[model samples]
Target: MPTSILRIDASSRSCGSFSRDIGDVVERSLLAKHPGADITRRDLAQQQIEHIRNETIIGYYTPGEAMTDELKAVTLTSDEIIAEAKSADILLITTPMYNFSIPSALKAWIDQLVRIGRTFDYDGHSFTGLLPGKQAYVVIAYGAGGYSDDGPLAGADFAKPYLSFLLGFLGIQDVTFVPVEATTADPATVACEVEKARQNVRSSLDAG
Candidate 1:
């Protein structure tokens, strides 16, 4: 069977976006491996998903058979997002760090996907993820350096850890994170960082 890839980009900038550029490299590498892969692209910047609402929360807890039309309508986006994730064999997320975290649009997308009894299940004691056997690749762009373990600003980076935990919570344990740091530095530094990120993407794909 052909591979299925869900590519979600969270950068607001259309042009000169390092995250998107790195995503392009990742996509190309995947295509090189799986020439007939089915790729689904979700550009959050252009088509932002609405944040979860009160009605949506209520819809999640309501039994399917007992859900009213209004409740069903409020949770339609969540349904679609979960469906997409369920069908994908690989989840590719390319996002730029915003204020030391992920962008609002990306967070909204995540909120829609992390639905109970849809992507995961809980019995008050333990939780189980419904979607397993999927791999994820996350590419993050940072404006300033020092987000890595040895970096000075490591503690300030919430994007990497949050995403790592989120993907694992969704049963995507086989995940690779590629960081593009120091994007707002000098042109030479920016170029070096971008190249390093590209190399990381290629190496990761090659290893897989």
Candidate 2:
């Protein structure tokens, strides 16, 4: 069981977000299993994160102790963001399909976590991840396309493929996808997707 959870919400909508609903279910299930689990929430809709600035990049490249005061200020936000993720045992990333991709805010958050020198190490020939031993659940909400492994638009999904790649790049191989798709279709179709997601969540928790 995860002793700490980092819940990152990328949905633009706050009230009726399907991804957030799925995250809520997952968080509740986890809480049931690990009763005092600590939850750290980063709601992108509420938190404003800018894209990686040139100054921040320079600051991040410089050693933290050696960086100047100006550079330290530039990289402080991203530093804090990385620290949060580094402390978590599980990450629940709920992202809605924004133009067939993630929201800009979520992208910014990812940029912060994928910093050089902090989350990875280059051994000349290749790189090794510094953040491992954690699991991730990606809950993607879509209006029409069903992008699961067996869905008709299976190979058409760029979100899941990209997210999986990002996780692997960070040495996070134990990842699960909970897709809630075809929301603009009939009620039956949406319900079917929700049921499938619920089942997947249960199975994931059980297997873990």
Candidate 3:
């Protein structure tokens, strides 16, 4: 079946971002795999949403409550972001590691979409995810060094694990990570790793 794919980019360094370059390849791979798939690209670097405020939060939670014109205008964008995520069959994220974490823009987007009773709900005992049957693919690029989820540095980091946890909480346990590491290792080595990542993406698509 044809799918609706949402491609999100969270790299700040426009043309020079390795993650963006890799993300393009991933998008191309997706298109080749599913010729009928529709793609929606959201570049966090370019079109970033401001951090939600207290008023925006109030507006988001107030179902039928009247809001000031300004509040309504701010909340509308958040509503659209939520709608896009909910409607997508899959989400592909391309992000560069900033100080060993996710970019602020990406975090801001999450804040908007992760509304109570929207993306998730608290049952009697625990919170249950409302979004299901969706898959996600994450591509992470590092400028220096590398860290694994089980590595010592991973515990101190909020980028990778936080993203995984939030998405998993949203019923997307089938998330996959394709990390392009060792950027500071050597220029040649970084190029090789990037190629390897692209090849892996191609192979995955081909298998599908």
RMSD of each: 0.9, 1.7, 2.1
lDDT of each: 0.93, 0.86, 0.83
Highest TM-score model number: 1
Candidate achieving higher lDDT, 2 or 3: 2
lDDT of 1: 0.93
**Can you tell me which runs of candidate 2 are displaced by over 4 Å?**
none
lDDT (10s digit) by residue, model 1, range 35-75: 99999989998998999999999999999999999999999
Query: What C-alpha lDDT, on a 0 to 100 scale, does residue 71 get in candidate 2?
Result: 92
Question: How does residue 138 of candidate 3 score in lDDT?
Answer: 93
100-135 in candidate 3: lDDT tens per residue?
Answer: 789899989889888887889887799888789998
> How well is each residue in 1-119 modelled by candidate 2, as lDDT tens digits?
54999999998899988999988888888888788999999999998788888898898789767999999888888889999989999988999877777888889999888988889
The stretch of ten residues in a row with the least summed lDDT in candidate 3 is 145-154
Q: Which pairs in model 1 have colliding backbones?
A: none
Candidate 1 vs candidate 3: the TM-score winner is 1
Put the candidates in TM-score order, highest first. Answer: 1, 2, 3
